[model samples]
Target: MDQPQNNPKAYWRENLRYLILLLTLWFLVSFGAGILFKEELNAIKIGGFGLGFWFAQQGAIYVFVVLIFVYVRLMNKLDRKYGYDEEA
Candidate 1:
């Protein structure tokens, strides 16, 4: 539900901003670090596995899972801000 006093455009704009920022970060970690900068990242090792290899294999998945939680938190905050949140 939307409030008459709330500016829908502004709320949507902010939502889009968060989406873009988070998606861009995901892209950088998944594609940029896993592929584009793989050689450089490979120099660093975690658990004896190259960082690049880790990112390509597991890091991206972890980041995505974290991002899901972050998105949920962000949306909850946004909903409250806009008075669109439901009583839970």
Candidate 2:
């Protein structure tokens, strides 16, 4: 006999911590390190661009892409752990 699928809501509930962590990182890089602390970070530059500006522009985008991949990987792990994944 097959086990019933875990509730979708339970999966989301269990995964909420991951969402919060990713959001915190997103906030730190985009707001804290980019806008709020721009002046302090101006001492650093990359290819003639201010560190804050880089973060606000290219850096944040790169982080976002990485975050997407991370989320995918983590969700795969989480799904397996919760027995909601098709792979297992």
How high is each candidate's TM-score? Answer: 0.89, 0.83
Relative to the true structure, how large is the alpha-carbon lDDT of every model? 0.90, 0.84
Model 1 lDDT tens row, 1-88: 5543357887898899999999999999999999999989999999998999999999999999999999999999888787678962
Tens-digit per-residue lDDT, 4-51, candidate 2: 357688788868989999989988998887799888877898899889
Error of 1 at 37 (Å): 0.8
Residue 1 lDDT (model 1) = 50
Extract clashing residue pairs from model 2. Answer: none
User: Cα RMSD to native, each candidate?
Assistant: 3.1, 3.1
Error of 2 at 85 (Å): 1.1
Tally clashes: model 2.
0
Superposition TM-score, candidate 2 onto the true structure: 0.83
